[model samples]
Target: MVAVLVIMTAGALLGYFLRKQPKIVMINDKLIMLAVFGLLFLMGVAIGSNPTIIQKLPVLGAQALLIAVVGIAGSVVAGSVVYYFFFHKKY
Candidate 1:
């Protein structure tokens, strides 16, 4: 995982440098969206394939949903606080 992350970071830096060259163009949003959906679908399929996991999901679904909601809310609140403090530039 660390190696993968390092490789991805290196690739992103390389892309950023190359993008400063004159001939580059932005990628299409449609392709980006399609790649996102494809990755999400594959993740779902991997998670769905475990029969033992699927069997217990009914009992755990509400707990999972609650955790997910709380996590999302926490991230949004944290992001807003960071932005207000650092990016507002008025202080």
Candidate 2:
């Protein structure tokens, strides 16, 4: 956990210092996308390798779907409230 925090802090500092560099920002974006894809692939591999997990996937998937739907609904409601209060007023 400490290692993760340290790495995250280091990345944040590096991003702050390099904020003005468009090339570096582009590379960073690509690297982030690649990392996300790699992580997802690894996750799929891990799931595929576990028979018990596979057997439980239907229940897990329904729970995940419920969570995702609730999350999206909450975000939309919260975003609408913020927008109405902060940005939608007539100037």
Candidate 3:
């Protein structure tokens, strides 16, 4: 967990410093997409090799779906509130 946090912090700082470079920003998007797909592919491979997780996939999927729905709903509510308070009047 600490390693993950350190890596994330480092990436955030790098992105912040690189924000002024449009070429780097454009390349970052493509690189991020490639990295995400690579990570997903590796995750699929790991899950495919795990017999226990495969057997419990149905339960896990349902829980993941529930969490996703709740997260989306919360985000929408928060976004609407922010828009109303901050952006609605500007428009």
Candidate 4:
């Protein structure tokens, strides 16, 4: 946990210092994209190789779907309320 926080802080500081350099920013974007793809690929490989996960995939899928539905519904309701209170004209 400490190591993770330290690494995150270091990355934050690096980003802060390098935010002004356009070339570095472009390179950073590509690096981030590559890292995301690599991480996703590794995660897929891990899940594919796990027999326990394969057996529980149906339950996990159902839970994920339910969570996604609830999250979207909540977000829509909250956004509508905010808009009605702050942005909608009373007239």
Winning candidate number (lDDT): 4
| Stretches of model 4 off by over 4 angstroms after superposition | none
Question: At residue 53, what lDDT does model 2 achieve?
Answer: 98
The Cα local distance difference test for each model comes to: 0.85, 0.97, 0.97, 0.99
After superposition of all CA atoms, the RMSD between model 4 and the true structure is 1.7
Per-residue CA lDDT of candidate 1, range 1-91, in tens? 9999999999788877877665552453456688999999998998799898899898689898999999999999999999998888883
Pairs clashing within candidate 1:
none
lDDT of 2 by residue, 1-91 (tens): 9999999999899999999999999999999999999999999999999999999999999999999999999999999999999999796
Predicted structure 1: lDDT: 0.85
Model 3 clash number? 0
Residue pairs of candidate 4 with colliding backbone atoms? none
RMSD of 1: 5.6
Better of 1 and 3 by lDDT: 3
Clashing pairs in 2: none
Ranked by TM-score, the better of candidates 2 and 4 is 4
Give lDDT tens digits, candidate 4, residues 4-60: 999999999999999999999999999999999999999999999999999999999
RMSD of each: 5.6, 3.8, 5.3, 1.7
